[model samples]
Target chain A: MVKLTLNVVMAERNISSQELAKAIGITPANLSILKTGKAKAIRFSTLSKICHVLECQPGDILKYVDE
Target chain B: MSKWLKIGINVLIMFLRFGIVAGYFMLIYPIIYLADAFQNHTTHAILNGSDFLRFSNNQQATLGAVKRFPSWPYALIMSVGVVLTVWATIKLLKALIKLLSNIRDQNYFSTSNELALITIIKAQVMMLLGDLLFASGNQLSQSWLLRVNTGVFSETWETCFHDVFQIIMLAAIYETYRHAMRVKAENDLTV
Candidate 1:
């Protein structure tokens, strides 16, 4: 299963949901959807925005969890 | 799914609104009859026919007895039948309208779709119960008024069976909607 670690990265970066949403040009609702792993897919552009804002590699925000 | 087909359904629903008005008007007559019967202590000859109303060999002898009996109960039953039918028609039209709007919004899979099917089931159930009451009233009165008001008992009973069949069909559609909603949820959650 693909587990999102975006919440963890956000925590490490000390970025609030509202701040992240503003930085990524997304609504807080959508940012919450991603942080909670409810998003179906993340566009590369969105991922790039998050990476640029947090200064983290894509792998730092995603992980494969074997179940 | 065609434009004309959608419009046709809408027109049918519009006619049903007219029917509801007719039903409301029809509903008043029985109450008036009941009032007249109670006030005068003798009802107007609302209906008198055993032959055309199809009295059984057993019930043929009961015609004299039916006339001697008070007519208020039959009137009350008739009113109940009309009320149930009108209620069912209203529910059915509401469901159809909701379904049309859902289709218009491309909401093929959702709880609202299932709700429409459920409304149809409820309408059918109400009609079936109304048919039962009408059948019972028919047994008591066997009047031409009943025949004119609510058609044949056996026919409406058969129609109740058809409504049951329709309920089954709607249940199948409801199940399909449930499955479609699940698939939609899965798709929305997939990465």
Candidate 2:
């Protein structure tokens, strides 16, 4: 399964969810959905914005895991 | 989905609710009257010899009062049929009103709405069956049991065709709604 490691990246970057959501111009609820791995799909623009705000590559926040 | 559309749906729901209540009362009126007439043993009650249980009266009274009185069993069956028809109609209308209310609130693409549509379909089926049973009973009693005129057969077909068409339309709407809900759920889950 494709899993999001957004919480770990946010912790390492010392960035709160509210701050990252505001920086990426997305709602906190949507950010929470992504963080909780409940999102079905993420837009390329949203991923780009998140990567830019966190100062990290997409791989840093995403991972694949077998269930 | 639009503001004006929502307002229009709201008005339609209000009108629908009123109509449902009024129609329910009108439908049950005959049942109530039959029960009262039976209770008082009034000769005013006309059964038209449609009794599934009785075949004594073969004479079809086309217009006014006949020499024979309506048996209690026939009256009971007629009352039960009327009550069932009224009950199914009320349930259908109630489900419709709930669906309309949800639409007015822009709360479409929900499980509750789907269930409501299913309920409406079920109620429609019940009503259609009840109507068919009543019509067939009348026609059969006239032709086979009482052996009177069989003119009601044509009327039965006309009514059943209309009901069948309505059921088909409702089923189509249900399928479309089900597809829309699936798409909406997928879109909602997509971040």
Candidate 3:
């Protein structure tokens, strides 16, 4: 299963979900959905914005695990 | 919106309304007639063979007088059938109408349809019992409530066959619907 480490990355970057959501131009609810691992997929542009704001690579926020 | 499905639903709604009204009257008229007979309490009430269906089983009758009967038992014996037919049709209409609206809302896999199927099956079963009641009313009454006649028995047997066939078909329909609902739920959860 594809998993997200976005919550860990956000905590390490010392950013609250609402602040990150505003900086990335998405809703806090959507950010919370992604943090909860309920998101189906994240857009590349949104990922890019998150990476830019948090100063991290995509690899830091995404991981894969065998089911 | 599928045009054909919408039209079909509309037509079905119209027919259901008509059936509801017709069924209501069929049920109500007999009760009212019996009520009138009870209120009047005529000792010498000689009813026609064809018009007075409760006394239709009487083997002996003519333009003159053959037998006079009380009001209550005769009405009670025969009205079971009219009430059963009307009640079942009304229930069927309600379930199907709910199913239609659920479909219109794009909800195919639902418990409401299941409820409809169960009601349909139970209604048929009750119809078989009603047929039996109609038949037994004549015999058990011992020519007091209703007269003894072969026509009643023959009609009971015919309706029994029809009810059994309908029950079989309804069971098949319920099984098919359960399968379809299962498949639909799987599809919905695939994402």
Per-candidate TM-scores read 0.64, 0.73, 0.56
Candidate 1, superposed: residue stretches over 4 Å from native: A7-32, A39-67, B1-6, B32-52, B55-64, B68-70, B142-156
Interface RMSD of each: 3.5, 1.0, 6.2
Stretches of candidate 2 off by over 4 Å are: B1-11, B27-77, B144-158, B161-165
**Candidate 2 vs candidate 3, TM-score winner:** 2
Native contact fraction per model = 0.43, 0.76, 0.00
Per-residue lDDT for B41-130 in model 3, tens only? 421232322222354444544323233454465456557765776687787777777777778777777988888889988878877776
Native contact share for candidate 1: 0.43
Q: What are the per-residue Cα lDDT tens digits for candidate 2 across B10-77?
A: 78888878877876776664565467555854333223323223345555444333334344444454
Model 2 chain A weakest 10-residue run by lDDT: A18-27
Q: Candidate 2 chain B — worst ten consecutive residues by lDDT sum?
A: B44-53
Candidate 3: tens digits of C-alpha lDDT, residues A1-67:
8888988888898999989999999887778878887777678898899999999999998898999
Best by DockQ: 2
lDDT of 1 by residue, B1-191 (tens): 78887787677767767766765666675566467567743223434433234334344434556457556776677567767876887788778777877776567776887888888888988988877767666655445333332443333456667877877887887788788888788766533
- Please say which candidate is ahead in TM-score: 1 or 2: 2
Clashes of each: 0, 0, 0
What value does the lDDT take at residue A49 in candidate 1? Answer: 90
Per-residue lDDT of A44 in model 2: 91
